[model samples]
Target chain A: MKNIFTIIKKEFSRFFKDKRMVITVLLPGLLIFAVYSLMGTVFSGMESVDENYKPKAYIVAAPQNLEETFSSILEITEKPSLEEAKKAVTEGELDIVVVFPSDFSQTIGTATPPDVKIFYNSAERNSVYGYTFVTAVLGQINTSAFTVNAASDKFDLATGRDITGNLMSTIMPMLMFALLASGCIAVAPESIAGEKERGTMATMLITPIRRVELALGKIISLTCFALLSGISSFLGVILSLPKLMGGMVGAEAAAFYSVGDYFMVLAIIISVVLVIISAFSVVSAYAKSVKEAGSLISPLMILVIVLGMATMFFAGNVPHVAIYIVPLLGSGLAMSSIMSFSVNPLGFALSIISNLVITAAFVVLLAFMFKSEKIMFKK
Target chain B: MTEILKVENLKKSFNLSRKQQKLEKTYQKVKVAVNDLTFSAYKGEIFGLLGPNGAGKTTTLRMLATLIKPDGGNAFIDGKSIINEENEVRRKIGFLTSELKLEDFFTPNYLFGFFSELYGVDKTTAAQRRQVLFSKFGIDKFAEVKFGNLSTGMKQKVSLVISIVHDPELIIFDEPTNGLDVLTAKVVTDFLEELRAEGKTIILSTHIFSLVEKLCDRVGIIINGQLIALDTLENLTKEKNLEDTFFELYEKTTGDRI
Candidate 1:
């Protein structure tokens, strides 16, 4: 255990003491935050403009009685014909062209409802909002008239649910996994195989420490450093996620998850990081140089990415308890479950146990490889 | 004299792949890297294992250091078996070679403390030892400099200090002065003599004849994975000078074999 701490201290100092490593670990998160915040600001600005700015509307055969209602919301412009109004809308001079039947107000409360034709550009945000707003306004007028005649009570119901949380839960699991995997890839190989390539590992091996202790030390040290990098990247994404979502999902929806859900996610992240670092350590032990280790680990990184993406597809669905017995896949499912607010304790337990077991197995394998002179001193 | 290290016919063999055999232009697939090599080093003496490159000197040293297990037979370091009690063997011996390198990312001071801790040396004792070694090697001036930034001679000196950080009884160094300048070489040779004077057992492998003449009290000449000759330098040189004797043995062995 003392030897393990010694190794961990060495690795920690090697990483944190280096200016370049600190920057590599932190820059991604800061950049993600800035980019996402900028996106959010741009989107919010567009939304505010869409809400307040009156879109130019041309109403053909306007009813005199309803002119007062239309005057407040729409920039009403006169057009000679329905064709001319549509041409103005299509040419972008008008946001929407509304064609109301000549007897639109008179026909209300009668046998048939009047046909109203509205034309607007669907590609433009303002134009789309203009069309929906005009139709809703006309419908409101019709409803008010009917309510007055029938003496009915007005009804309004709203639910305090965040629909965007579901979208975030579906996407965040995969994003988190990819970000953490990248963080591990950036540093773990250098800590292990780099020592071998530089011939420093032999110096360590000749010491009085047991091979198992050395392997344990390396694994633990790498786990802590890799976990920090992963967390930094995760924070970048999590803090900036609302902005990147462009308020399509309400920013408040990100806070909808309980604190316990975050703890559970963090637990899964740590477990996943241990598995990743251990697996990379084994690959590094097998490699002759840091470059070779990187080449070998690239395929494993891709595998992690593919497994994490499975969470996106499986979001909102309950995963089988057996799925949580797999390493990377289980962590992904567990995280997805937490974000979706349907976490299963048994699944999380199994996932954590499986990850730890896998990590231990890899470390043992690395220790055994360390004992083999041919492997350790491979040309 | 106390026998600090003993090798009893240690043997090691490696299977040459088809490609390796082809590259060597040989038909034998199994090559014996170390074969029935036997030697002993006493306390307060420098034992030189002299041989050409690929002559099993390193293989022998590696076995004694417990870096690789001998295929047959065994060795003892301070009475600890290389095979059965390697960790204990490691505690008794300090092995240095060109292949065993200090990490370029670390400084000599940090590595000294790290190895001392691994050897279970007490902090105060380690600190005292580090101070002594740092001053002895002139390492105090650049104690915090990264190993990679040091000159080759400086790196070698630092490596030697770190190897013996725990003050082991037996020291194994392979070609300690292989790449040193004349002045640095003198320092290393003088240091080995100084350690010998202080009653430390030292075993070193070298092909340099002058190094052997200057530092070795005893010499073992190896060829083709076998120790062909072993004796004190005075006894071996009684017939002729050591160089002529080595060449004569080399020619006789090669002429008889091929």
Candidate 2:
């Protein structure tokens, strides 16, 4: 235990005392915040339509009874005939043109109602909105056979919280995995493989300290660093969640999650970080240098990305407990479930337990590798 | 003499990579590095394994240091098996080679404390040992300097100091002065003599004949992983000088012209 603590202290000092490394650990958080917020602002600008602009319409053979309702939505214009109104709309001088048969409003409820011809370009954004607005007004006044979703207080039935939760479950898992894996990549390999390359690791191997102690110490200290890096970026995403998701979700997702939700997510993050760091630590022990370890870890990184995305495809029903026990992917599943307010107690417990077991197995494998001179002393 | 290290049929071999096989100009899949080597060193003595480069001198010492495993047999350090009791063996011996490096990020002072903790040394003894050894090696002058910033000689000295942070009963050095300037070389040779005077058993491997003659109490001459001569310096050098005896043995043992 003392030896493990000693090794951990050494590793911590190696990282914390280096100003450049500390900067690297914190810079991602700041960068994430700035980039995400900028994306939100830019995306929102592109999707919004100007509120001051009204749809222009030329109504021909207008029904006297419905005239009052149509005038409120469209800029009602006078045209002599239906053919002239269609020509004006085709020329793009008018936003929309509508022809109601001579007794259209009166015939709306009859067996064969007069067909209202609305001419609007589907390709034009303004024309699309114009067509929609004009149809809604006609639907209200026509009082025909039936209206689809007309004047029902709120038909969608999804709350702001639901939207926020859906957004979180969809996007957060991938982003979180990517950020945390990157953090592990930045430090874990360099700790073991860098020491091997520099010839410093063998110095410790010669001591009375057990290889298990060395491996544990390295993994734990590296876990702390990875968490710092993962959390900083995570906090950045959380703080910027409102800005980044505002355009799509329409509600602040950040405001919907409670402290308990964050804690649950944090639990998954820690377990995931442990598993990643331990696996990478084993890779580092197997590799001869940091560059080699990085090459080896690249394929594993791709695997992590695929796992992170796995939860999204199987979002609502995470097939089986088998899925929850699959290391990195399991953490993603549990986190998505928690963030979306659909926590499965059994699956969550299984994923975290499986992570710890996998991490322990990796540590033992790392210790075995440490004792192998063939691997450690490979030229 | 009280034997402190015992070697019995210790052997090691390595698989040749294709690139290595190509470089070695051979189709053989394995290279025998150390072969059935046997010897003993006693307390208060410096035993030198003398051989040309690649003659398994370093390999033999590496096995004794528990840095590598022996395929065929085992050795003992203070009666602890290098294979079965590796941790205990490590606790009993201080092994240094050019390959064992101190972290460049840490000061010598910090590394000494870190290694001492690994060795399970008490703080008071560690402090006292540090005071004596650091001053002796002149490491105290720059004890707080990060190893990367230290001069080459200082870095080597710091590595040597840290290797024996617990002051183990046995010391093993592989090519202790392989690439030293003459002045730095003399300092190392003098340190070995000082260690001997303190009654610590030392095992060193070197190809330099003069170094063996100047410092070793007994010498084992190895050629192609086989021990060809084992005797006191006086007995080995009674009729012929050390170099002539080595070449004569080399020609007789391997049937190669010198």
- Stretches off by above 4 angstroms in model 1 are A34-161, A248-254, B256-258
**lDDT for residue B254 in candidate 2, whole number 0-100:** 85
DockQ of 2: 0.80
Candidate 1, residue A67: Cα displacement in angstroms equals 30
Per-residue alpha-carbon lDDT of model 1 for A1-379, expressed as tens digits? 7888888788887887677876776666677678767865664213223367898888777788767878898888888886777766655577787766777778766776566667775424466678778778777776633222122311100111222344446666677677777778777788889988988888888888888999998888777777777778778767776666554445465577788887888888899988988888899889999999999999999988888888766645654689889888888888877765677889889999999999989989999999999988866
Model 2: per-residue lDDT, tens digit, B1-258? Answer: 899999999999999999999988989999999999999999999999998888998888888888899999889999999989999999999998998888888999999999999999999999999999999889999998888999777877887888788998899988888677777788889999999999999998888889999999999999889898999999999999999999999999889897
Model 2, A253-283: lDDT tens digits are 6767788888888889999999989988988
Off by over 4 Å in 2: A42-160, A247-255
Considering summed lDDT, which 10 consecutive residues are worst modelled in model 2 chain B? Answer: B176-185
**Number of the top-ranking candidate, with DockQ as the measure:** 2
Task: Name the best candidate (by TM-score).
Answer: 2
